[model samples]
Target: MAPPVLVLCRLAPDTLAEFADRFRLLDFYASALPIHAFLAAVAADGDPPRVVLVFGGAPIRVGAELLDAVPSLRCIITISAGLNHIDLTECARRGVQVANAGGIYSADVADYAVGLLFDVLRHVSAGNRYVRRGLWTERGDFVPLGSRIGGKRVGIIGLGNIGSAVARRLEAFGCVVSYHSRRRKEDVPYAYFPSARELAASSDVLVVACALTAETRHIVDRGVLDALGERGVVVNVARGANVDEAELVRALADGRVAGAGLEVFENEPNMPPELMAMDNVVLTPHQAVFTPESMADMRRVVVANLEAFFAGEPLLTLVE
Candidate 1:
């Protein structure tokens, strides 16, 4: 009998069907796995399957535990960009091949990032709120408004696929784009800054698109915020742990930075109380890659990953 493939994250019908047709798919699972508490069912079933595919947004904690549970597991496929949810060390130790979909959702996230930029900078959301509250009728009195994104300085941290996508989108809006990465990428046309602080200081909008690793955990700290000053706005589509939650709250609270558009938080589903109270900021529940197009694309790639594995071919989009 072929080795069983355990699928997690409850993929869409087509992706599920495609995977099913390609592999010896195991027949137990459900939707809505709480990411942080993903291990709530760590090893609930009988024997662990040989090939495990995690399509959900759960963290590496669950992945680590799965390695322990599924001693026979030889491969893991994560359907998202961030592998922080997958335990790399344990995978290496056990010789489990791991793969991820880093570039799959880049465009969607970049569009969302720029959307937040325009909304916050142009007061688009606030303007809608203005009319909803019947304030537009008494519009003779002027509300303080800001300038357009046109020609505004945009600073991007992490010049990866998403960052480059953001740069291209922002550039079309007539915004000047500069980026800072650990090692500068030579292919992109944007100007490069050596440090986050320098980029934050130089741009009107500083966006965090870098990965969340030891080198970048809370890289967007108080010093970086201080450098950004009161006129600059911040946008983070990357993992929330990239910024110090307390410092970000304080920054927006005291006008250290003008505003922020945050889609991810340090502790999701439990936002800081201060964030809810702020009108200048826009928050999303980790929905940067939640668009229909992106969702469809994500599903397609995930199925392909599983298909490739079952075919005894190299995995698509493997994580280094």
Candidate 2:
């Protein structure tokens, strides 16, 4: 009999059907019951799932409560590069293997990060809004002039795959790129600052591309924004909580920080009302990694990880 694999998020019908052919797929997204009760019922069944497939965007977290309910679970496969939603410590404690979508979306996310930065610095989105509102004829070229992208000092928050890719793209545009990470990367030629504050202090623009963790949460706060100063801009392609949203609002409102381009927010699908009125801010739904090409790559990586786990081979993208 095929091993049961519990699925926790919405997936395309074709993707689900592909998995269903090789394994018994337990559809958690379709379940009407609460997660705990749903898991309870699944556990009560004779054949419990030994694997759980999850993705980002869903509120479901794979932690102790969910882990405890599925005693048979030995593996977790997530179709996301960021593992913030998964409890790595708990998975380690239970001897459960966790595999993530490593480097699959790096190029796409980096491309989007650069796009966001350009939108902020060049007022691309704001100019579009101005034209769309028919203000150009009424105002007669009163739209604010945009800053040049070349020769700007850009500081990146993380130097991982995504961050590194951002740095490379920015470098090609004649932007001087520096970075702040947990540790200085020996392989990269970019200058490294030991702290975010110092990085912000020196940068013309700050691009946040770090992961979300206890330490990284609110890493960019009022102090960092103040350091970036009134002429500096911010572009966040990382998690929303990485920058203190309230502080950012205050900064933008008071003109302490110049502008922003944001993809994610502290509370997703709902953002602060103040941002809607700001012409300098460009907001996109969490779609930095949703290109069709990247989605196909993600599916391949996910399937490979699951195949490796079930076949008793080393995972292609183990968290550790």
Candidate 3:
């Protein structure tokens, strides 16, 4: 008999079929009840699932209570690069191993970050709007001037895989790159700042690519925004909570900061109304990691980790 696996998020029908071939899949998304109620029913059934597969945007939360309900649960596999939604400490304490997508989306996200930066600097989206609205026909080629990307000082937060990829791409465009991480990376030649504010002070553009943790929540607050000053631009591909959204809105409204390119928001699928009216701001619906290549890579990593766990092999991409 195949091992029992609980699935807690929406996935492609083909992906579900693939998993079903290798495991006895218990799909929570297909259940009529809420996730907690479903888990309660499963717990009452007295045969706890041994593995759980989670995907991004799942409402099901893995906390101590949930873990306790599934006494036989040993592993969790998440198909996302970020693990902010998971309780790592609780999982560790309970001897429940956790695995993530393992940098599969890094290149795609980095490419999107650079694309956002370019859009902000060149006013690409705004220009398209101007053309579509017939403002160009009335104004006769008198659009506002855009800043040149070359020779700009770029500061990156979290010099991890995505950050490093962004740095490399920016370097090809003749932009000088510096970074701020939890600690300095010895291998990289880029200048390192001790804090976000310090990095913002020296950079013409600030790119946030860090992971969200307790220490990193609101890392790009008002102070850092102010240090970037009125002429500075911010491009965030990281978690929305990493930047204080209220403060960011205030700064943008008051012209304390020049502009922004955001792919994520504090409240997802619901962005601030003020940002909608701003021509200087460029917004995307958290699609930085949504490329077909990245999705395939993510599926591979997630499946590999699950297969490793079930086969009694060392798990790949173990969260630690």
Candidate 4:
């Protein structure tokens, strides 16, 4: 008999078919009953699932309470790279091994971050609007000048897999890169700043690529934005909570900061209406890691982790 596994979020049909082949999947998402009632019924069954599969999204939050409902759960496999949605501490306390998508999406996400930065610096999106609206034909060929990307000082937060990839790409474009991480890395050639403010003060553009944790929540606050100055740009590929949304809006509105490129926001699927009207801001719908190639890689990583867990082998991407 196949081992029992609980699925909490909606997955692609192909991915679901693959899981069904290897495990006995108890899908909470497909149940007609409310999730709480379904969980209660499962708990009463007393043969709790040994593993749970989840995705990184707002709807499914795995905390102590959820963990308590599945006392037999020994492993959690998430298809997303960010672990902000999972309660790592509680999982640790309960000896639940956690696995993530690892660096499979690093290259794709890094490429998107650089793309956003270029769009902001060169007014690519705004230029598209100008051309489409016939502003160029109506008002002659004059358009607002954009800053050059070459020789710009770039400061990156987190310096992890994605951040390091971003640095390498920027370097190829003749951009100087520095970074701020929890601690200084001994292997990297780039300069390391002790704090985000110091890094922002010296950088022409600030790129946020850190993970979201209690220590990192709102890490890029008003002070950091101010340090970037009136002529500086901010690009965030990390979690939206990493920057204070209200402070960022105020900074852009008052012209305290030059511009922004955002792929994430404090609220998913919703953003401040003021940003919609700004030509200097470039926004994407959290698609930094949505490439088809990356999606395939993610599926492989997730399956690998689950296979490893069931085989009693070391997980491919264990969160430690």
* Cα RMSD (angstroms) for every candidate in the order listed: 3.3, 1.2, 1.3, 1.5
TM-score of 4: 0.96
Measured with C-alpha atoms, the lDDT of residue 281 in candidate 3 is 97
> Candidate 1 lDDT (Cα, whole model)?
0.80
What's the lDDT for residue 127 in model 3?
92
- Residues 56-116 of candidate 2 have per-residue lDDT tens digits of 6654788897888988899989888888889999999999999988998999999999999
lDDT of 3 by residue, 3-77 (tens): 778888788887888888888777888889977788877766546677788865777677687688767788988
Q: Which candidate would rank higher by lDDT, 2 or 4?
A: 2
Task: Please report the candidate that would top lDDT against the real structure.
Answer: 2
Clashing pairs in 3: none
For model 2, the run of ten residues with the poorest summed lDDT: 51-60
Task: Using TM-score as the measure, name the better of candidate 2 and candidate 3.
Answer: 2
lDDT by residue for model 1 over 1-320, one digit each (tens)? 55467666656676677666756665345535653233334344454476776754533344556666556678887777887777787788777888888598999999999999888887777778788888888775336685588998999999898999999998888999999999988887888888899888888899999988899999899999999889999999999999999998998988889989998999877889988878788888888887778877776777677767767888888776
Candidate 4 lDDT tens digits, 1-320: 78778888788788789889988888887788677777766666546687788887734588887877767788988888899989999999999999988999899999999999999999999999998999998987736788899999999999999999999999999999999999999999999999999999999999999999998899999999999999999999999999998999999999999999999999888999999999999989998888779878877887788889989999999999
The best candidate by TM-score is 2
Per candidate, the number of residue pairs that clash is: 2, 0, 0, 0
With a 3 Å backbone cut-off (N, CA, C), the pairs that clash in candidate 1 are: 59-85, 60-85
Q: What is the TM-score of each candidate against the true structure?
A: 0.88, 0.97, 0.97, 0.96
